[model samples]
Target: MAESKVLYLQKVKNQNVSHILHKIWEHEAISRIELVQMTHLTSGTITNLTQELISHRLIKESESISDSVGRKRVNLRFDNSYYYIIGIDIGRTSVSVVLSELTGNIVDTVEYGTEGITNPEEVLALIEPYVHKLLGQAESRKRKVIGIGVSIPGPMDQRTGKLINPPGFPGWAGYPIRPTLEERFKTKVFIEDDARTSALAERWYGIGRDGRDLVFVTMGMGIGGGIVQNGRVLHGTNGLYGQIGQMSLMTHGGAGAAISYDCWENLGSIPGILKRWSGNGDFRDFIVQVRAQEPHAVKVMEDTLRMLEASLTSLINLYDPDVIVLGGKLYPYLSPHMEAIVENVRSRVFDFVQERVIIEKAFYGQMQSLMGAVALVFGHVQENPLLVLGAD
Candidate 1:
């Protein structure tokens, strides 16, 4: 009983230390005095923890600053070399791997085609060595690879860590991504819906940081969204809260059972548009041509915007987020069409609701999902004492 009590007390102290270290990382450059105030930990405790962190090279003291009152304070900042994280964005056509520091700076990146990833084992084999090589180039050993975060297209089961019948990637359904990656990397791994991961990226490092309640909509091969309320990603009971592409928007409820057009993905997803306009060259390429003032491309652009507007209007009415961020590979083409989308939604939605919601494009662009995966690891480190102490 006495040993158990001692272990519990030690665990509590470790948790506090981790939380304090996270605060320092978030603030970037903070003084010991400020840390004491922010963490409400005694000066003695702060000194001990900060000393341990500095000794481990997890944090370092910046050059001292002399205040007007003849007092000098040392600023503490995260030591970028302390560890590294790997972010993997596995999309339909390709997979992108980024190696970044704890401070969120990219060290190196590699992209490879997924044309041959029909077998799940093959996909893992391709990813594993590339990650190893990237870490080798950085001269970072396995111990320094803190975590691996994966972003994939999904109608996924977050709890079970399974991709549940994702329309975009047919072979990925029920894939045990977390365990597979964990086994390969021999480290902690996280798997999340690409849209939600993109939203997490925005919240942590992009525009949504200013707003507590926000929605991120990705208009790409498939249309999907992620919602952040009160600074937390709201995963529903089945972890599918942001799978908005399935929301029924058409009056006819879409073509037929044989066609699989009932979901919003069939109505507004990029592929859906491509299927609708079979005569068109690539829809994305056509959009670019339209933006450059090609005449035939104009009609395609108009029809795409109208379909997107229907989905946007439904989301705006339902979530009523403070901000709605548009992103994904297709967002560039959609930028010029933003005005039309806003106009359609404004005209359809309740006047009072329309007045409050603001729509904008994602500032981070293609990197949003990748960065969000990093944020997942960072967020986990922030919350877990065992991980934090282990990292230090």
Candidate 2:
């Protein structure tokens, strides 16, 4: 058989093994009997799979837990500290790095300001020290580094493992982020668009845990977002799916429905909003001004919310997701007005079905992107258990 075909066949053969591990990890601890029940695999098969994972140190036997009858049962749980995943979030304003265990619990974090630094080599230089620092911390804990995950600005070329003219970072257009990091770390590395990383964060740790469809939006910088449907991030052709900022607004209503190209990002960007709201304050100051009921600040916020209501109405109709999560610098400021925004969207949605869409604030704080990076590696392990098995 051809090499490619052989490799493809090998993946599913161990899918059951990996599935068993996920069940164990998800529940924190479980017994072989529970695994068989959850996975619907035979008791013998569950035994073999659990044994295989144990042999690799991917999971370990937890101490006996007494049941209702006081019978000691051996519970299985992930060897949380046996392996580490490094997550990096490279934002326009700063770079954040974190080391996390198998359970997605962050251990150490490093942050450095970038102030929109886009020079590829300079960016790499800033990241290298933090990466080494976290790796050092992991080694102190006796955890082997398994892989690295990066949440970065996009439009990235996933197939080529390169950045493609990322916004405000044009010079990094052709940088090979994946290969560069893999070479530096001597392990597999994965890069995902920052927005999608938030969606992953939700799927793994936030509201997305309940459902298969999720949309995460960032109101800061520009109106960026990511889509998750059926538990998979959507990377359209050329990896440019989540351009929520550019989603054209329905400027007017009619059969012709006067469409405007003035996207939310352009109209609602930080500079533009502040510029419109008296032109004298940063976002924080603007929030204070709004709280103080300053006319200009109040007016600008109202205007933005009007468009936000329209934008969200359009979003719900178009995507039809189970939930839409909003976060970023602007979201908190909008908290006082969230009820109004939701009510307006509810009243404006196309029909009753679209009105059922649940819009909520982002569950995580600064940890969103960084932890999203952690989710990336955990996702890879689910699909390819060899990361823990020390298989290439």
Candidate 3:
């Protein structure tokens, strides 16, 4: 009984310390008195925890500021230069790796095409050097690589950390992505679905940062979504929460099933728009023709945006997010018609929902997924400071 009580008290103290550390990170730099006020922790406890964090090199004291005449108070800030995080975005067309500081500022980046790559072995080999290259940079800077975050296509089993049969990638079903990366990197690895990471990136670093409720929709190679409610990414059961691409527009779905079997992806994805074109042109050409007012391209895009409006209406009615963020290759095509799209969506949905929900472009643009990876690592550290501090 006594041992259990001691354990409970220790857990409580660790939680308080972690909370204080996160508060410091959020405020960028804050005084000890401010931490005490914000966290409502006792001054002695704040002093002791901050000193412990400083000793571990996770945080440090900055230059003193004059709080009063003849009196100075030291400010506490996260030691951003002390550690580094690697964020990897594994898209269908390319793989991108970024080395970011503890504060999520990107330091360096490398990208490579996966044109001929098919299997997990090839992916592992392709990413290995990029990881090592970034590690070399970290060594030169005298900073340790603390964590690696990966954003891959979805239907992942979050509990097992295994990706399950992601679309557009053959033989990726049940791939041991997390364990494989952990073994190679010798550090904690966090994996999330690409769309979810994009949403998390927005929530942690961009426009969605100030709001807890937002939905991120990706319409590039495929149509998908990520939902953030009350500042938490909704993983749902089996990590399939935000597979909005599969949302059925008809009674029966998938190819060759008739018009009643269509899904949102078939009508709204960038590839979907390209399918309507007779020429062998890619998404870029399709966008070019649309801008040139080519009749076929313009008609396809207008129809696609109408489909987008219907799908978005369902999403807004269901989730009621504060903002609906749009991204992917299709964004460029949609931007010019945003006013029309917004008006169309408003006409279809309820007045209250249409008035409240704002549709905006992705804040970080192409960097959203990679930055989300960095944020994932930082979130883990914030939740378990002891793990990073070598206490657990």
Candidate 4:
């Protein structure tokens, strides 16, 4: 076989092994036959891979035997006690850090609100202490930390691991978040767009688990999107594939109109909806009136939903994904009109594609982004076992 083909086949084998290993990790204990049933890898393949993992000390054979009757079955499981990972999420309003076990369970978490501060250094300060605390906790517990994964809001240079002109963090353009984290934590670091990371988490642990092609649209203070195609989060050139919020729907002429700004974020974001509301109350009160179907509240919501429908229609037509997951803070407002929203989107897309795509709510709710940060590390380690397993 050609060298490229050989490497491709090896990658496929590694992916299969990783999938089976994750299945074993999720379950407290699972037998080889069960692994075959869960991952659809042949029993022989599972046996060989599990044996390799056991020898590498990445996984282990459980002392307790399986309850199968025909043959004695030894169970396989991840060695959670052996290592740890840190997952951090930097949002427009808050920063959260989670310590996760090898199996992807959250051992502990630290959070701090940003309160609208956008300076790059200020943002770093907000998260740094929590990151240190989490790292210290892991050290005290005697767990070796292997990697750090972070979810940041912006366009990132995937190759260089630098944030490039992120909208949420104004002064953070061109910051080297990944390299800084790696140097500070002294571990492998990975960075991904916040919304896309959430989509990854959904694929691994939520509703998208059963489907390979999916899109997650987050309607929050800012609008964001995460698109998954063929079971992987799509990262286009420079890793800016999921910046759906910047896609323009219309153009307007005004003072400084040369900028030609009419992005989906300005049109369909929660803050935009709140700004349009004429009432003298806060967001909580506005939501109360919206649920009550008050006239002004209803009108703003209808317009917001219409704009969202237009943006989402464009996305569905472009990607033709199997599912679209709606999430984030604004979902509560959108939930009451979800049936209509989905129907509206379906009506706008091509007939042949509409019926195949299902619209649903996010499984992890608002925690999706934070959880996704952890999933990123787990995913990296799974794909490259040598990172966690050393030269074994």
Candidate 5:
């Protein structure tokens, strides 16, 4: 009975501490009084936890700032400079590695194409030296690395931590990505689906920061989705929540017999859209032709964006998010047509939902995935300072 009571008390204490830490991070720099009001905890508890956090170097006291009436109070801020994060994004076309501070600022980066890469081991081998170089830079700046975060394409088994046959990259099947990195770096590693990571990047560092519910739609070699509900990534039952690529549009085969179905991603993806064009040309040239209103190019694009409008309408109906973020290889090209797409989608959705939802391009542009990987670590650390710092 005593042991059980002790365990219960410990769990409650941890939750309190974690809650306090999150409040400080959310507020950026906050007074103990503000923390007390926000957390609904006793002032004594706030003071003790803040002091403990300061002692552990997770947080620090800032210069005295005067509030209204000139009463000076010391503010507390997260010590983000003390720890570094290594963020890696493994895409079918390329692999990118970044060294970032807990603030989601990238300090260094290296990238390589995956054209000749045939296996998961090769991808890790490509990442290792870049990681070592980034760590050296962090070491020179006296930053302790907290962990490594990876963004990989999905169909992953969370229980196994192995990617199970992601699209485009057959070589990565069954690879123990988490354990391999943890073993090599001698530190904890966190991995998330690429789409989910992109959403995390948006939630923490991109245009979705102000949005309570956000959806990031990706269009590259493939179409994917990442959804954030009330500031947390929505990983539904089995962690397979955001597979929006498979959203069906129509069925094929005989009138009565069922056959393979056509879906949103089939025509909305970059490659799929390009392949549909009757004439062949370079991607950049194709974009220029579309912008120039070349008859064939414009026709192909309008058809694709109409499909996008349908899929986006489906998304709006399903999630009713505050904002929808569009990104990946196809977005820049699609930017010119965004107004039309937005209007078309709005016309089809509910009146109440139409006015509130904003659709915008990703602010981080090409770096969204890498930023997501870094934010994954940032989120984990901010949520559990003691666990992350090995103080628990």
Candidate 6:
């Protein structure tokens, strides 16, 4: 009978632990008292779970505190350093690898030109060494790597973790990214659209912290968006919810719809704009001259702004998001154009949405997607501690 009671007690403890882990993930951080109240569990239950978490290095006592009447209350917080995640952002011209703590802080990053990406195996080979090297520098072993998160140019099927006709990356279509990486590293892997990943990063760590519904717009080789509603990314039936670039903004009877007309990629994609304005000149040199405010360069900037304004207006009308965030390589050059775009949006959007909507540049730098991939790993760990902690 004593042995039976012990087994039953262990089962009860496991259930209570599952509840505590869910609460922490939902709240991000919580006090012991708050956890008790939130879970409606006994103080003993909370204490046991918290002790277990601490022992497992899942959480740590935080430096931040709230002063109580007697002893100060040292806050308990998730220990992001307990593990690390690898984030890969593969763009048209380059691929970037970031090693980030569970809390989304980047420990190290490596950017390499993408001359060999036509061969998927070659790209993976190049990435593996850099990842191992970074782990060595950080004194972290492969066993500590929680997962690998990859963000690439879309359109992709998130459910299958495969690229489906990715525009810029011709050879990557139908690539078995998640399984390939998982097999190679002997670890879990996640794959997501680049724009969607960026949006996730903004929602958790950047400008979207205060707003639940937002649209993250990426203006680079092509334009795309990621939509978040009620704190969850809106992955559509096809797992491509926010492919806003395909929308037809202009009435041109082209292969793309009307929304595609105003899309920066279609009319003013970075390469497209350079091609349009460079006039047989060196495109890189032209951009440099534009940055220096040469007279012709000023005209190119103005043209880019006009297209941007029109595209933003269409987005505001369609989505009515709480906030619209501009990010990607082109963001720096387009910073000067924001005011004009905002004004255009105001003029174009209906009064109700115009009054409530906010347009802003991304708060996070170029590495936002990499950080988001870390968030994806940590978020999963928090949601299902069973994935980390075994039964009792």
For this target, which candidate reaches the highest lDDT against the unseen true structure?
5
Each candidate's TM vs. the true structure? 0.84, 0.88, 0.89, 0.83, 0.92, 0.82
Please list the residue runs of candidate 2 whose C-alpha ends up more than 4 Å from where it truly belongs after superposition.
2-9, 63-73, 251-260, 350-356, 390-392
Instruction: Write the residue-wise lDDT of candidate 5 on 95-172 in tens digits.
Output: 999888777877788899988787888877888987888778778988788888899999788777798888767888
Residue ranges of candidate 5 with Cα displaced over 4 Å: 1-3, 251-261, 292-294, 389-392
| Candidate 6 weakest ten by summed lDDT | 251-260
Candidate rank order under lDDT: 5, 3, 2, 4, 1, 6
Residue 160 of model 2 has an lDDT of 76
Per-residue alpha-carbon lDDT of candidate 4 for residues 1-392, written as tens digits (9 for 90 to 100): 69888778667766777787667655658888889898988878888878888876678887756364655777887777768878889888888888888766778887888876877678778778777887787789877777888988878888788888877567678888888878877778888988988897888778765546899988887888898876678878756688888888663434767644478887678667777786878778888898898988888777777788888788887888888888888887678888888888888888887777688888778788988888788777766675654432
Candidates' C-alpha lDDT: 0.77, 0.80, 0.82, 0.79, 0.82, 0.75
- Residue 107's lDDT in candidate 5: 76
Over 1-392, each residue of candidate 6 has an lDDT whose tens digit, in order, gives: 99899778766766677667656655667788888888899889788789888887778767655556665565677787667788887777777898887767778888888764687777777788887676565554543777778888878776777889888786888988888878877778877888888998887667665446899988878888999887667888877688887665443434664632454566667776776576556556777888788887777767778777777777777777888888888788788767767877797878766667688888777876667676566556654565666655
lDDT of 6 at 230: 73
Q: Candidate 1 overall Cα lDDT vs. reference? A: 0.77
How high is the lDDT of residue 32 in model 4? Answer: 85
Q: Candidate 2 residues 15-99, lDDT tens each?
A: 8877886677567789998898899999988887788888778889998888899988899988874888899998878888888
Cα TM-score of candidate 2 = 0.88
| Model 6 clashing residue pairs (backbone) | 247-259, 247-260, 248-257, 248-258, 248-259, 249-258, 249-259, 250-258, 264-269
Clashes of each: 0, 0, 1, 0, 0, 9
User: What range of 10 consecutive residues in model 4 has the weakest lDDT sum?
Assistant: 251-260
Alpha-carbon RMSD, each predicted model: 4.0, 3.4, 3.4, 4.7, 2.9, 5.0
Per-residue C-alpha lDDT of model 1 across residues 226-323, encoded as one tens digit per residue? 99986668888877798887787543323663433367778667777666555457775766677687654566566667767887787888888888
In candidate 3, position 170 carries an lDDT of 76
